[model samples]
Target: MASAPQQSLPLFYNDLQPLSSQQHADFKIRSADKAPFLAKQHAVPVTVEEFPLVQRFMPIVFSQGEEPVPLALMGLNEGINTFFDEDGSLNEPNFYVPAYIRRYPYLLARLRPDSDELSLCFDPTTDTVGAFEEGEALFVNGEPSETTKNILQFNEQFEQAGARTGQFMKELKELDLLIDGEVTIQPDGAAQPFVYRGFMMIDENKLNELRGDQLRKIVQNGMLPLIYAHLFSLGLMRDIFGRQLRQGKMPEPQLVQPTA
Candidate 1:
């Protein structure tokens, strides 16, 4: 089941500190080969811009809440990641990694609650960026280095994409196109199908029933393809469950009685 960040801090971040030359002039950011923080993170917030790429890799579902955010499911169950090994390394090298994961350790956040401005910030708890001798320099001669500029640019783009994602969600809600999501998978010789819930997805029935003008509006505005991408990705849920079973990460079968 997926939920939004419940703590004061966002997911995967312990604390956020503004990036500044005065405080971290000598800091360098080291490239990490493995993402230990993502080992147990089954669901990650994804932007609408990534729907096409995400659909090819994982099932895209919205979190269960009044303000549901789109999420990419790495595994059906909590603490299970089919794509990541126990050590946080990828199970396969060629798998498409989400932009949210790639944007880790750095993000643009508002320093004040009332401010419209956002500053580049990083997780100070991470070893990825610090006063390290080896790695890309964050600043050179009291000015931001090229590496820092690139990081800032990436985070900025992410923020823009995030805003677009929000608008997409707002439209979906306005049209009443979202519904509680459920999936049932039955392994060979199993007594009952494994029913998975606690997520939200597009109400395909509602989508199909929309007025022709409403349908045309979404298609013209590019929301239709994203919706189809999400629907198509649902089939990957079974594939993910199979991966978990093969990797020995599947939990003991919990059977549910069939409804009359």
Candidate 2:
């Protein structure tokens, strides 16, 4: 049920343009109270560093693919977000917003395929940053302002975390600890259970079957707790289903017949 953007551009970004003081010296980044871009985004790519906090708020699962990336599910189904309203305002306060969302409109990306260096980039479609009269200044006296510096620092940290998350995924694959994920939730008076699939999750059975040294290795390296966090957060699947049901976003039930 969780998938990242496979198109030419990343999720929520329509187009990317490298940020340069020459072209955008007078640009200012406005704080947005609402993020319409997140309204229909059900899953967002997350880093391993976010698992501890992400698990507390939403289920963390892997997208189904050859190179599966960890994703934080905002809703069980596509185009359904339980936490945010249609206007992209939080339905409830004090929610742990993912860094992936918080870093929107700005990201560090390699401008050239041949270059190993990454440049600061932003989505021009977003009104968050532009040549606006009011808001945080992006540059001061032809140099990056404090606001821009902070944004760069945050994006750098995010990239580092992304690398760590990639390593974590690689380790899971090497150990064969990931499996197809499925969740079945049956609400009271429902004719059939809601079966959610199309995602990957930790294979607890395989995890338990690992050799003692293998188990100890992961535990000592801190992967064990993250795995457990993912497993424990799965209980929130039912909670998400309930939210969809209450919000009238639940799709018509698809019943699976018993095999004769």
Predictions in order: lDDT: 0.85, 0.84
lDDT of 1 by residue, 158-186 (tens): 99999999999999999999998888898
lDDT of 2 by residue, 71-108 (tens): 88888888888999999988968578988889888878
Q: Which stretches of candidate 2 lie over 4 Å from their true place?
A: 1-7, 254-260
TM-score of 2: 0.94
Clashing pairs in 1: none
Best by lDDT: 1
